[model samples]
Target: MIKYEIPETLKEHENIIKRTFRYSNEIIFKCEETKPWESKLGGCPYLKNIEEYPVDEEGEPMLFLAQINLSDLEKLDDLPQKGLLQFFVVNDDMFGLESPIVVKYIEDYEENEAQLIKENPYEDNEGYKQSLPFSNNGKMYFETREMPISSSLELFETLFKDELSEEEYEKLSRDCYSCNSRVGGYPYFVQHDCLGFDDEDFLLLQLDIDDECGIMFGDSGNCVFSIPKDALKNKDFSKVIYDWQCC
Candidate 1:
């Protein structure tokens, strides 16, 4: 695990951003604006105006409009740190696993035990050979009580609207998702579904403690931090990241 002290200045700003984006935050405005043809699928929607309306492959104007709330990004400037980090899983063929593994939030122990064995056959063992424990893939979920900042713009009359090309739209969508999942100057923990592993397979994770720390797994839900274990002797809210596997 890794540990770092949260500067007092950053703590207040962090709290402000959390409270502003909270479920109870008041919506002060609602307006509509055309997503410029160039802005279609882009990550930062607030930075540019729609130049042309969107259209289909046949060159017809597409009438797909999103209803968004405007107050979500009103106080964005107050956020301490703002940027998106792409969090994705890469399959390791040497270990034999698929990409983008699903991470689940474990709620029931008894029910999950049977389901784990069914989903992961590798956990089965013969006499004298111990069975590997199932990975706790479903133990984390976020409650999006309110709309995100980027999606707050409501539908408006468009002077220049054109359909976005398929390739352009796909790239924009990916970038949009990446930005939405970004960690905003706060400490958060995200649990990923474990990949298939042999006795020696392990994870090589790069943690950004200044932004977020820690990953958890299993029934005990042991949290691994980036800070060394010995360094946690005395610290308050010491951010850390860690990794662990069953023996």
Candidate 2:
């Protein structure tokens, strides 16, 4: 959940003044519901209004901040969900002048959230399903382990061996992406994409070759498994993930 707060000092910033004017103008045009001279100024429903005052901070114009309500963060936990933020400007022209800058602010929000939830989609879901958060492609790749290898080189050998001749192996070796990091070393699966196995751990290097990578593993490799993406959306991953090993 994110809360917006405008500092009293914002009135002194040149950029803030521009944003306020733009936001105020947008609100006015929206209320009137008429198209601007330039078609670029389209209507947005989220921006409620913009207000201004006569007072100035350090000789700059005083402006009321634009109030915007972003999507409820709690409800968006999967790839198909859409989240947005909106700003209300006083008139179309005013907002047009500052659209480029204000749009940057919106993009920033998306980038920040993407990084935080890339792996742990259900971290905030309290508790519902127990499974790792994985992109559709990611889930397919990591569902099975090829075979245990004693070292990084051995792992690479297992993937290319028997399937390709010596010449083909040379070409594959040149193209293959390799990382010798401890987290994805021998005996562990390497997925093309990742899934959150826990708050701190992830299923790494599993390439979902066919998009249907679902598997359950236990001591005897006798665990029932299915694609849990549908069941896990908007639910907590911690509650659904049952077996996890960490070295």
Candidate 3:
């Protein structure tokens, strides 16, 4: 929904603008102060017990990355109807990019806040965990938008010039791409190439580097996960591909 008046410079290529950028429904994560069991980026998760918490290959407790309460999000075309999907990654320099990452799904949830795990599992990383949002978590909100995604940068240029100089490309694309933290939409990448994703894949989650939350992924990088469209419909998150990149 390009509802806003187009920029004076880009209004000339309105049709190409529509075709160059793909618009999709996106659920933006609006960070807000919340309880531990609520959907959030950090803090302890809603686990039945400490045993239910996911650990890394070395048996170290993984850090809380994010938790999505499917019930909170409504009217999505390819989201689980009702459940809790939690994301956890090991505490390391790579943040489980190479190591085994964890994604948990709970069809039935526990509403009792006191019954859930409250104590942080990786207490040793208290200082490091500061990078995550311990006080607030993301609240899901929706919008329809189109932007020049990194992968389509060249296509956007082709419409105007055969090839743009480095300076021209940077200038033309300045502030034109999206860098929103969202689920189920076109992705934003610091790097142009995303080898792990393809046509059959759907953007499951994307957490962009945020200074407000003190979250960073290797110098302004973005962490993203993608799953097959069919799998998403079936609520199968077992084979998600996790990837991240920086400028």
Candidate 4:
């Protein structure tokens, strides 16, 4: 559970603001509904404890000093209109690292521009399903591993020990697109196009050739896995993923 606090003075608020930057955890904003609640990761309903709720000395709900400033709220690109606004700070609990994020619950709130960000942030990046505080279908670009190797052959060798002949490597390393534009970093299992050249770097790795999935490496190691359309019918392909989207 996260401990919430309300800064009493501008100095305390300033300290909190500084702590936001210094903390090792990555803080993300989320709005949780109390009445018809929705998880940040989506699906089930969530309810905050009324008794354990962070309140002032008088037992009233405490609001952070910085949260009272509209200017600070404007700085957020996407803000939600309803529910309690929480800063879900990501921390590695295994190492005894705790999140210092504070949740601010308010009533009769007006909508803000920052709320435009999609709700479910784990649409494609399934890896974040466990880490994120709330559930939403938003795009997650967090890369747990390093970007793909520069050489396609090297990347192939890294994933599969078998060496690809020059001809085979050349054929697979053709003009590839990264979805709509050139997105740097890792790739995921994506759709194909009529041109045969979709957002991928390599050709389909046949089951006979390599049981594991094949990845098409792009510049800066941004890549997409090469799974045949027919393979989509198999649930295993969906389970194996290498998340490497740039922030």
On residues 114-225, what C-alpha lDDT tens digit does candidate 3 reach at each position? Answer: 7766656665466556544233444445566555443333444455454445654455566456676766645676776454454456776778765445556777787887
Candidate 3, position 181, lDDT:
75
Q: lDDT score of model 3? A: 0.64
Give lDDT tens digits, candidate 2, residues 159-189.
4466556765555444333222111212222
Would you list the rank order by TM-score, best first? 3, 2, 4, 1
How does each model score on TM-score?
0.17, 0.19, 0.75, 0.18
Number of the top TM-score candidate:
3
- What does candidate 4's lDDT look like per residue over 54-153, in tens digits? 4433443321111221122222222233343221222222210122333333434434423333222222444434333222322111111112222223
In candidate 2 the C-alpha lDDT for residue 195 amounts to 25
> lDDT: which is higher, 2 or 3?
3
Give the runs in model 1 whose Cα sits over 4 Å from its true position. Answer: 1-118, 126-141, 145-247
Q: By descending lDDT, how would the candidates be arranged?
A: 3, 4, 2, 1
Q: What TM value does model 4 have?
A: 0.18
Candidates in order have lDDT scores of: 0.22, 0.24, 0.64, 0.25
RMSD of 4: 21.7
Write the residue-wise lDDT of candidate 1 on 1-247 in tens digits. Answer: 1122223433433342233232212211112222211111111112112332232344432221111222222232322122211111121221112222211111112323222222222112231012111111111112222321121111100100123345543332232221112112111122331322111211112121111212212333321112222322222113223333311
